[model samples]
Target: MPLHLADLVARSELHLSVVAAPDRLDRPVEAAHASELLRPGQWLQGGELLMTIGLLLPMTEEACRAYVQDCAAAGAGALVLGLGRELPYQEAPAPLIAAAEAAGLPLLTVPDEVPFIAVTKAVFAAKAAEQHRALERVFDAQRRLTAAAASGRGLTATLEAWVDATGIAAAVTDLLGRPIAAAGLDDLDPFGPAGLPPAVTELVHKVAGRGLRGSASSASGSLGSVEVQPLGANRLRGLLVLVGTLAPNDRMPASGLVSLLSLELERRHLADEPERRRRSALLGRLLTEGVSAEHAHDVLAVAGLASDTVRTVAVDPSGTSAEMAAEVAADLALAVPGGLVRVHDGLVEAVVGDNLDLIEILSRFASGAPAGIGPAVPPEAATGSLRQARALVAVSRALGHPAQTREAHSARLLLEFGDRRALRGYADAVLGPLDSADPTGDLVRTLATWLDTGGSWDETSRRLAVHRHTARNRIDKAMRLTGRNLDDGDDRFDLWLATRIRQEMKAPGT
Candidate 1:
């Protein structure tokens, strides 16, 4: 269905004849150009017909062979040697013929009466005619596609009509990379349990992460060449993917399809705004103020995040607007079913079920943003999860990456999630009188050091760089104020643990 060297040679008006590589005359010709330089191949692109008048031509047998090799190497579809009155050669040279035949490069001879301009005109005319016909077909296909879209039959019918018109398989995916609609041209169905091809799926997320700045890109994979086009007007709504073989002209219909499909997705997104707002409100309520376990479960169930246990994932909205962070959360929402995402206070957070793999979800959608995943907790205890997430989020930001609560490996885990009132009461009851009386931390340090050294006065004094008498005096004064005895195992252990807890919580997370 493409113009080939054989077609040009077979034309009666041009008076052209194949001089070499007769069997290889079927090479496709994409364009035509003329040059008289020795190595004319320098100007040629692949599938071009190069015409020369033998000026400054290589005349030797070896030189001719190299010339033909150069032409073939440059991906010239055919070589046309003009034989006319003013040209160096009156006919095809034997060396040139031998070289062309050896290299399997189709060589054509133009009759003296036929000028090189006629050959160039013929080549481009055929190309223009082909393009014109393609445009005509595209116009017809656009009308059919528009009708299908206007029929209100949804994306499938519009895609089906486009496929029937252009013979290209296409699919649409949400920002989460979930397949929304797919239309295959023939027996190849893009929609299956296996889902979209890995390359297409990757591009979907890549474009989704870029939001409004995203553009179109293509990749080759198991499905051959696939092109991904981002869909939306003011914001990203989804991705439109075209898979399989595509002609240059095929972009015409694909663009039209993108416009039609983007409108539909935008409409759907607008329609879902109220529900999204409600879910966001519920998440805010669940995070800031405590929600009843039953009401939390109801909210989670209504939001589609149904799990007896769930973890809270929070991303600090640093160097980005709340709107931008919220968009990122919305993009991540489709990474899993029942993934509830919202912007509460200043952080972009999500309540995801523990049953799903959080790591993989984050890997696929989180990109470069720092995320902190809190420990799995019940719906009623989500407030604590948010607390832990806030604590770890700073660590993640400082580390310039994401982290999980399980990765903390410190006392902050228990200290953050435990009852704040009870822990505060315990610390105050244990350290209150001593801290008030001493004002400085010497007494607490002496008691902790003495306990750490197994009640060794000398070791405590040595560690503190003080005399044994001074350490003994401090310990006695601490005992007098706190009413605790170091010789008792219970008192010693409680004192040590309380001091460590206080030290760990001294610097809090923002």
Candidate 2:
């Protein structure tokens, strides 16, 4: 506890008296200063007890009021008057008393027998003792926290010890403001809002972005106090958030706690890196050929995954650069329990057991970014499942849907089996005569447009920027050259398949 005016006056040796409105004696005295200048407040700082005589003060009420007002404005914690020799008055002046009451400053009176040095010595002794006690408390808390961390359950134990010491709730969050660890809160979300509160999350971003340490509080008292400290060096790693009241001295210990927590988190990260790499390689092997089912089952059992059946998800972060999307996917995959994630050929793939909530886990990583999820399949069929997911991703992007699962897009499986050479040969066989007959290629273009427009001649003509009759003639010429009857369902299917095959061949990697 700090030294207050009441604590000073209660000492029997000092023989101090409370002269004017003494209701405010609870104000803490951070320091003690003695000055006889006309305006002693000039040399004073807030939370200080200013002791003086009436030597430089005027007898008039107005002069005394101005003097008291200045002390109050200067944030003087209390005014102590020595009234035996310097000033002939037996008590504090009436105007000074009234002004102190109005300004809510405590006023104390000391006898001439008590030397000024005695009061200063008392304040010094009290402050030193308080400092010693504070240090003791901080050191003890640090020891307990260190013990908790070394006891094998480091993260959770450290957090629980911090709560016991500070009586405050704390949470550790990633750069995305998602909580990775928490204590003293009912839910895993210790921030009190769904996900992270946007205001504090924005602050976390700024701190991580600029390598800054920040503290903010709610004046409305709704959130008490909030402090954010960055983790890691050079680059931002994570953040620590504390929500509660803390004394000025408590802040130092809080910072020390943050440093300890960061070390533990980084230690775990370094320790887990090798395992993460091993799981990634295993997933890669499973997706490729040559890994036997028995060998794969052994690996899956070692990694705590189902050996027989697994589900894989392919995330397509449309419009984002491949590098950034891959990084996010990798992080999410590693975070998921018993899951393996890999990024290849512009897609993020995760292989997990059948019991996981695939949608919820993907949503956490996707965060509104579009993705595609393949159906559950046997371990040997993982490659085919991923291909189906990739095709669905393409279909979803083309149709302007956010995401598509295997059940919603089973037809996309047809796209998985076509050989590039065979597809190209078939396309040429179906459309080769039409291409040779029309030097301008109008017949092929008209046929494509007519098919895309659902065989509506009017819509096809409007899309081609030509008259309806001209479009009709082009279609008739295409049918005659191909020797395919337009009214036959089989011929129409063949024409559509050829156009699709040609389109796929023109794609970048094909």
Candidate 3:
């Protein structure tokens, strides 16, 4: 605790009497200075006790009032006067007492027997003790945090250690404001953007958008206090979020931890280079030979993308700065632990698990350039999604924003205003037999693609990743079931219209 006016007045030896503005005695006195100048405030800094013997001797009420107000304005914690018969005033003068009271400055009187040095020594000693304690706390926190970083237990361990050392909840988020590692977040989901508070997430984006030029930001919220600290030496690598207000003396410790966490992130990045390269290579192979190969499945398992449902994303690398593009690529690749991300040809692409909130990630990284998100499909059918993603990237550019596969088929959104039940009935009438015969959807998909390509077998087969013979067989099967003649323009038109309607009207995930 700091040395307050109350602390000195309570001591029996100093015999200091609080004669006015007693309520203000809680002000801390960091130092004590004795001056006889008519205006001593010019010589004093804040948090100092201004002691005087009334030597310049302003005996009038107005003169006394100006002196007292000056001291208060200069941040004098309190006014102390030495009382003695030999001095100008034996006791604290009545004019001075009234001035101090009106100014809301604590006024203390020193008896003739007490020396001014006693009070000055007391203030300096207490201030020294407080400073010593503050330094000790900072050193202790730094020691524990450093040890945790050295443990090589990863980012999570260091974060947990930080909370333990300082008792403040924290998390380290990637460039997208998604928590990569967290500690003491008992009330919130420890990972993903969905779990974090919207305000905090917005702040993360705001600071990250500024790069290294931005500084830390703090906000008051339901969680008491929240702070966002950007982490990086050359470019902004990540953010450190303190979920609660720090202790008054915690700034140094928090800064040290931010530096330590940055080192850990850089180290992890270097160490994971080979693994990232391997995932990138695997993604390339999947895009080429398709994901049906037994070896593809084995590699997918190792890459932590062992999911049946995955999405392909196309980000235009030309729109963003190299540094930002690199960060977003790294983030999207690790989005689902071993996600496959690679920069190929003229674009940056990634194979992400569909379970994550990919739209949010894409929105943050889009900048002015658009990204295309493919639909979720089985691993064996990943090539179809990649093709769709690349196609939509062109559509996204035209639309002036990031887009998804559904947006490319703009009919779905526009047709919703119509009588959906009525439209479904018409679609069912035209394609009901094909839907029933091909419950697996392969025939319906082939028929739609065949009609979409003006009855071209090779194009349909390539889009569906099937043999041209197989594609012709499925189209023929669909023609027989639907009673439609491809040779007739009217029949082809109705069949194509119905397939588009039926496919669009189907609820998502059906």
Listed per model in order, the count of residue pairs whose N, CA or C atoms clash below 3 Å is 0, 0, 0
As for candidate 3, its clashing pairs are: none
Best by TM-score: 3
- Per-residue lDDT over 1-510 for candidate 3, one digit per residue giving the tens place of the 0 to 100 score: 677888888888899998899999888888999988888788888999988988886778999999998898899999889998787777888999999999999989998888899888888888899899889988998898899999989888888888987888888888877788899887654334475678888878888877767655666466667888888776566888888778778889888888999898888776877877888888877777544657657767877666777888888867567666666677666555657887776677888877877776676555666678899987767788888888878777767677788786645543544577777787789888987887898987898888889888889989999999999988888889988898998888788878888777675852
How much lDDT does each candidate structure score?
A: 0.80, 0.74, 0.80
Worst 10 residues of 2 by lDDT: 406-415
Per-model TM values vs. the true structure: 0.63, 0.63, 0.66
- Candidates 1 and 3: which is better by lDDT? 3
Top candidate (lDDT)? 3
TM-score winner, 1 or 3: 3
Q: Give the TM-score of candidate 1.
A: 0.63
Where in model 2 is the C-alpha error above 4 Å? 85-87, 174-178, 187-222, 233-238, 290-333, 341-510
Q: Lowest-scoring 10 consecutive residues by lDDT in candidate 3?
A: 409-418
The number of residue pairs in model 3 that clash at the backbone is 0
> Local error of candidate 1 at 173, Å?
2.9
Candidate 3: residue 401 Cα off by (Å): 4.2
Off by over 4 Å in 1: 31-76, 81-96, 137-151, 158-168, 185-191, 197-203, 212-221, 251-260, 277-305, 310-336, 339-352, 356-510
lDDT (10s digit) by residue, model 2, range 331-422: 56545677887777777777888786666656545655556667778877777777777766765555444344643532233444445577
